[model samples]
Target chain A: MSVSARPEVRPAERAEPAGTAPQPDTWRTRLRRDWPLLVMGLPMVITVTAFWWLPTLGNVIAFQDYNPYSGGIFGSPILGFTNFQLLFSDPQFIRAVTNTLGITAFQLVFYFPVPIALALLLNSIMSPRLRALVQGVVYLPHFFSWVLVVAIFQQMLGGAGLLAQTLRQHGYQGIDVMTNSDTFLLLVTSQTVWKDAGWGSIIFLAALSTIDPNLYEASAVDGAGRWRRMWHITLPGLRPVIVLLLILRLGDALNIGFEQFMLQRYAVGSQVSEVFDTFAYFSGLKTGDLAYGAAAGLFKGLVGLVLIVAANRVAHALGERGVYSKS
Target chain B: MSTTDTVIPAPGRGGPRRGKRGRAPWEEPGSLAGRLGKGGVIAVVLLLVIFPLYAILLTSLSDSRTVNAAGGLVLVPDGISFDAYRQIFSDTVVSRAIMVSTGVTLFGTLFSVALSVLGAYSLSRPGSFLHKPMLFSVLLMFVFFPGIIPTYLLVSSLGMKDTYLSLILPSAISAFNVVVLRAFFMNIPRELLDSARIDGAGEFRILWRIVLPLSKAVTAVVALFYAVGYWNAWFNAMLYIDDSAKWPLALILREYVVNAASLPAGTAGVAGYGHSVPPTLAIKMAIVMVAVLPALLIYPFVQRHFTKGVIIGAIKG
Candidate 1:
């Protein structure tokens, strides 16, 4: 995604004389002038209102004793904090939250820096052809669906998989890492790294490209070693982007992805694999407890909002522009 | 070294301090040990990325006997046959799923791109009527998500539970893509748009003639993103679609390749209506290949635009 672009508001028709600003158009005049544009924007407005805003507002059902046939969202009896009270007391719900946060924190430490390290490695490659080849190969897995990635991992790591089959052939006991719930966190983390780490490196690679070649040359001419130059020049140049992405990651910490966990939940059992999204699905939708599940989801959303705001505040405290500016 | 061997030698040692293989003059080629270490790491990374894909491709093309000899997935290609491919192509479930996926991706991409373009262009101009609320709504979507159960209820309530529209509409509009498109449209020289307006062109005509032509790269990139999202989506199908006949290729891939592998004797149920035997290992690999092949085929064409497209959306958003 494009970074560091300020909104360039150069309204074509409104580029009047600098000193003398024209009077703002009357509402009637502006509406007459811009109706076609309004018409053009109507579909998106309706869509966002219907699918996004409406569903978000539908979270009111979280507080109600919601039943589809017996008094839907509007007709359901209000239960105040009853649904939430039940949610916090449920062991499965607590487990889902714990597993979700635990995975997010684990990935932040292990998976976050992988792409940065990869970008540095890629940047040091002297041959453009080799670098391009490596980039293309690494980026391929990112495009594969979660289902396909899971299947590939299964073929390599599961019982009767290549690893196990080869071991059995060699007269050793076979291993099945895919179904081991104890190491499910590590398994999912590795899968994520395999799938996304290379693609994630694109942003850092872009940041690296922006660093001037002259700085490297100047440092090298001063007799600085490669590692020293990286420490002094390269990493400092990457700091802003690094900080920016770190803040974004913190903001998005709650969402550890859905399809990945959902696909593996049955295999590993939901105890280890049930994150917030799957928890909501299984408990609320699958079990037909509409309000209770919605309560769980709403709670997650509100916490996410708090996390993002807090992360943005931290960014500002660190003197870097976070997601949104002070304005 | 090769250039020097060709006799186009430097005038003097002081002329230009060129290093080997077009390395910059100030750059060090590093010690032999360090070079080997870096080379080894790079080799492993490439192998980690490529080996799985290579094995999957080979196994899909191998005969049942060859796959059986390998015990699971074939790494070394001893023989090649298209029996697995033929088997999948003839299976109604797979063929129908492929058709469903293709239709959804095509229609979904078109619907998303059309709406996004119109929406982005309408909001491209600053100080337009109702622009603030519209833009605010789009931007707000980035921060807050309408949780899953609510979204599910909406779909069911709308009578779109079993329909393909459920797959497309819920995720049809991405705020980041709209922002990217809007950014690109705004970057287009106002002179072009103003000149067209001066020449009696309406806003639509101007957008069609001036803005769209200039913003084709961003639009194509946005369309690619939407198409890929539609193609790879399975969770939505799993949630909203209960009718097995309408399941997309991704869901089918998940069922036959992923979930089936974990089930005890799972392949027993995968054979065609009257067939007795389970699908071979070759057929499972083939299913995985079918899911992946489109992404591979389309990568080279769209690969170049990703940096421009994504970086724009990321920074702007």
Candidate 2:
């Protein structure tokens, strides 16, 4: 919480011999100074209020028995915590929690280091042109829709697909990697790494750029080899960034891509692939239990918010800059 | 080489430096160990990322006989043909979907970038009335969103359902983009704004005339992001637009690749596998390539800006 310590203007602070301070032109001058900014911001205010803030009021319907056709949000029957109660009692909802947590954990353990490792590798490259070319090739996948990524994987690894066909040609059994429930978590994490590791490395690269050249030079002067210098100097320089990104990842752990899972849910079956976002969507939109779904979404949102705040606090405690400045 | 220039200074730092002459245990030049170690990393990266793309390209180019004969994994096309791409282009639904995707992406990117720039500029001001609250609200949106149901309900209530606006308005300005643009705006010197103000140029004029010209890098990156988001968007289209004809390229791609078992009859080619209209591995690959090509084409031009564009905004928010 970077709360500014600036004091609000007191009447005494502006006092000019008591009576001389009362000038009608002062208000006009202040308005003139600020009016352009206010006017410039008008469209955004209106747009956010109408589209974002007003719709946010609809979150209250989570506490009501929301009937879209019968009555509007205001007219809906009050149902207290019944929606939340329903969500808690459901087994599938519990599974969604476990599945989401599982995915996040897997990503943290496996997917998180990929970008850092890639950044290190790219940093080690002596040729700038080759580094840029490799980066271009790698980062291209990040912009692709999950649909295309999944489709590519399926074309290569799905049953009766390229990898399977290759296996048959080699007189080996086909690998069932895409559809198998047991391997879905690994599959998702690997796919995420493939798509994002290069793009994610940008931050680490930025952080790497800020590292003092003197440290490496000093290490070289001390007869330290490449591995020794990298382990001590380079890794230490990257620590703050790693912590910052880790905290950010912790914050977004719950939002492990809705469309990615939803598109492949039918193929892999919801029993394995179901996550909090998709669960909320299906229950709230498809099933017409609006309040129930809203409760689920709200619940996830609250947990995510808490996680982010807590992570930020922890980072601050660890003496790092954290996600934001704590002035 | 620099590696061997200064190696005999000290021994307390670590083991002997791996100069050009003194190769380390890991750097066994011309040895099986070095080749295997370096080769493994390169091979894994290539197999994981490049091979799928290669498989898709080869499959899309190959004839049906070559495809089936090779068991859908042809490193090289036996004989090249553009039949799959030709077939996709001829299909009215897919062609219309492509047009819809293009229109949405173009309009959405323009509107989003304009709004984001304006909003970000205003928010970047030091003492604007709504600055703090607006900034906080935007950050809050990043964590506790109104989620899918409420957003869908809001979209439907606004009567944006099944319309192009449904694809654009609800997501016209992303909070992340706004934050990024605001950060970029903040980096502009306050003296510039003051000078513009003295010259009788309004905020919008200053933003347009000065700020924008200087912000070409970030603006291009953000616009490309918005365009890609619009192009690849399927969730909003899936939820809001009920009409199959209004589907975007991604949704169509999703149907083809994921829901392969449910593809319509009579669409199956002569080399169909069974009653399922078994989407030839080639068609899936073709659709995947089609979906990916737009971003790939636009990315290189904006690649240089990505580091600055993503980092500055991300850090601030």
TM-score of each: 0.91, 0.87
Q: In candidate 2, what are the lDDT values of residues A1-327, reduced to their tens digit?
A: 010222212222343343443333354444555566667666666666667766677889999988888877989999999889888989999999999999999899998898899887766554556567777877888888888878777776888676787787899999868889989998898888878887787777766766766676677778777678889988998998888778777867788888889977977899989999999999888888888888898888778878877876787788755445444
Q: lDDT of all predictions, in order shown? A: 0.81, 0.74
Cα deviation of A146 in candidate 1 (Å)?
Answer: 0.8
Q: Is the docking of candidate 1 incorrect, acceptable, medium or high quality?
A: acceptable
lDDT of candidate 2?
0.74
Shift in Å, residue A313, candidate 1: 2.5
Model 2, position B316: C-alpha lDDT score? 23
Return the TM-scores of chain A for each candidate in numbered order.
Answer: 0.91, 0.89
Instruction: List fnat per candidate, in order.
Output: 0.56, 0.41
Could you give candidate 1's per-residue lDDT for residues A1-327 as a string of tens digits?
011121222243344345643455668657867888999999988898899999999999998989889899889999999999999999999999999989999999999999899989888887867887888888778888899889999999998788999999999999999999999999999999998888888777767776777888998999998899999989998998788788878888888989999999988999899999999888898899988899999999999889877877898798876655555
Candidate number achieving the greatest lDDT relative to the actual structure: 1
Q: Largest DockQ belongs to which candidate? A: 1
